[model samples]
Structures are given as structure tokens and as C-alpha cells.
Target: AALAQGRQPLLLERTAGLGGRARSLFARDVDSMIDNGQHVLAASYHETRRLLRRLGQENAIHFQQPLSIHFRFNQRRNFPFRAWRLPAPLHFLLPLLFGAPLSRSDRRYLFRWGRRFRQTVPEQLKPLTVRQWLDEAGQSPLLEQLLWEPLTLATLNTPLRQASAFLLYQVLQKAFLSSAATSGLGLATRLLGEIFARPAEQFIRQQG
Candidate 1:
């Protein structure tokens, strides 16, 4: 953006790599590249998308359509949760109501909670633990195990008992309730180096 605006921007990397923790390494034995860690981007990551587009590497990221989740519980049991092509909140609602593995009672609880969540603001949430908030919200144990716990771990990198409820609420609000596209998952098809680092380096050198 700075380059486009005729302004010079200097990016300093403390480490040898540009991506920092979000980097890739070649596995010579398999002749393939692997990431240091699993990184999935939500469509709501506007800044990241903008940067990728600026670097002309937007197509390097493969995005899933309609936002679906497949859960493998065991070797024999797997559950598929698919979002419908409905508008805004209905996209979230129809999915959880009809597609998810929740029981009737669980669905009812979640529906009521969703209504409450829409009405409440993120700042209004207390600094309670995620587990405490879930309990207070009457989240079912199955729902917690199947959805909330995993999401909490992935997003906050902390256990639900330790993660802040306010932060989790903010994530949910931005990712799910914001828009249909916001919830779409994007996975980088190329190595992380090819996806961002190499292009960024080239862009910087051209600017110089």
C-alpha cells in the first residue's frame, strides 16, 4: 500500500525468515514443503487478503465455499456440519439447527443463546473464563466438546478454563455474525514462503 501511494516502507525482520512462526520448510525425503504450524485464515481477515492481493498471490490461498466443518470423532464416526446459503444470521442458524450433531435440547439452548448473543455487546461480557461463560450460557456438554472447546483452543491457543470470555465473544462476533463470507476458511495452497514471503521480498526489492 505504501509503495502504491509512492511512499517507501521498510520492513525489518529480526529473524532470518519473513513469515516468522508462519513459515515453511522443505522435507527432502518427501520432496514437499510443510508449514511450521497449521494456519487457516478466515475471510474476515481483510488486511491479510489485501496484502496478498497487493502481492499478486491472492490465488495461492484456496478458500472453501459456503463454510463447512467436518468432524472426525472416531475411525467409524464422522459428522459433517454445513452452512446453508442463507443470509447473514440465517446462514449460521439453519446450519446449527439442521446440520450439526447437537440434540434437540442442545439446539434449543444454542438458539436461545444466539439470540442473546446478538442482543449483547462484546464490552458487556465480564472478564470470566470461557468455561464459566459457557456454563452460564447453558451450553450443552456435547456442544462444548464438539465445537466450543476446539474453537477456543485453536483461536486463543488456550484452554477454555483459562481463555477470556470477552475475547472469545469478540472473535465469534466478527467471524460468524458479521457476514457469510467472513466465516469462510482459506487454506494456503502453496508453501508459506511462496504464498507471502518470497513475493513480499521481491516487492520490497523492486521498491528499493
Candidate 2:
């Protein structure tokens, strides 16, 4: 809003209230919202800073000083079997080096997988699940358990069995093949911001 412009953009909120989902109670002593589960803000998550900054609460939001990721497995879900790197390879390689989850053969599978994925995509939307491709490429169950699950769910929000292998492959290429970090820049931070806001806060407040 401080940005100087020839024409001021019209801003509106659909809801009667101003705060949207993260609202506040009438009194300063009250709390507004509580998210059910834990979430993270990556160092690379740019505008998150801007929003938090705008609210004069940037310091309040805990930015992962040294960003990290976690891998959880079925039923036990005890703790993340391990952590991963937010940017990608640097995070992945540490574990591979220490053999936290991936073994020597698993590492080879990852290398081969990256090389192969580097080569296809929206240009070639093949009909194979990532699991299928990995298995065919000789990846084992252990490899799938350790390396693939976190990515399948977290990155794409779908299971390997049902999700598009091509889509996941594209994500890998964008994250690993191109840049040092998948999240360096140019990625959309909030789909809602990009897609809405004539009355965005209104919709959020009243959202089901």
C-alpha cells in the first residue's frame, strides 16, 4: 500500500470484520484463532514476512531460522523418521550421507530418479505413478518408504498410487534440476491472494 502508483488499486473486504480467519476478540486479552496442527514458514517464504510485517508482527511469527523438513511414516507416526532440507538437494543429501533413511542402493535410485525425471513432464504427461516408475527402475520398498512418501503427500497432496507421476516429476525438476532451492523465487505464495481479494477477507471470515 505504501508503494507509489499512478492509480490506486481498489481494495475491499467481503466480510463485515477486518481480520479474516486470524481474527481478534473485542478485548486485547482475548485470542482469536488457533490452528489445529503445526505449520511452518520457510526462510524462502517471502511475502509471509510482508504480511506479518504489515501487522507489525513479523518478529512474532517464528521463521525457521535454519529451515528443515520432516518425514513421517504410517501408523507409528511417532516422530519424523527424519528431517529433510527445505530447498531440496542440500537437505536430502545430508540424510543420504548419514544413511538416516536412504541406503546406498536407495541413493542410487534417487540419483537415477532425478536423472530420469530431468528428462520428461507436462510435455510428456506419462501414465505412471512415481511408485510404479521407481519400482520399474528397481527402487525397493525401503526406498519408497523413506524417500518418496513425504514428497508425495507434502508437495503434491496426493498419494503416489493416485497422483500424476508427471506432475510430481515436474515439481522435482523445478525444485532440484533448475535452482539451488525449489523456493528461491517466482513461485506463488498464497493461491488465494493471486486468485482473489475484491472482498477476500469477507470470504475468509465466512468460509465454511
Winning candidate number (TM-score): 1
Error of 1 at 162 (Å): 5.2
The reply for model 1, stretches above 4 Å from the true place, is: 1-14, 26-32, 125-129, 153-164
Candidate 2 residue lDDT tens string, 43-114: 444566566554444454443423344555667652333325444554545445464555677777666655
Q: Score every model by TM-score.
A: 0.81, 0.49
Error of 1 at 136 (Å): 3.6
What lDDT score goes with residue 65 in model 2? 29
For every model shown, the clashing-pair count is: 0, 2
RMSD of 2: 8.4
In angstroms, the error of model 1 at 178 is 2.7
Local error of candidate 1 at residue 171 (angstroms): 3.3
Q: Could you tell me the TM-score of candidate 1?
A: 0.81
Candidate 2 pairs with clashing backbones = 14-202, 15-202
- What would the per-residue lDDT of candidate 1 be over residues 1-208, giving only the tens digit for each residue? 7887988887777776787666777779889888767777767777889999989999999877667778878898777877677776778777878777789898898788778888876765667899988888878888998889877876666799999999888778777667777777788887888888888889888987
Error of 2 at 145 (Å): 1.1
For every candidate, C-alpha RMSD to the true structure in Å: 3.0, 8.4
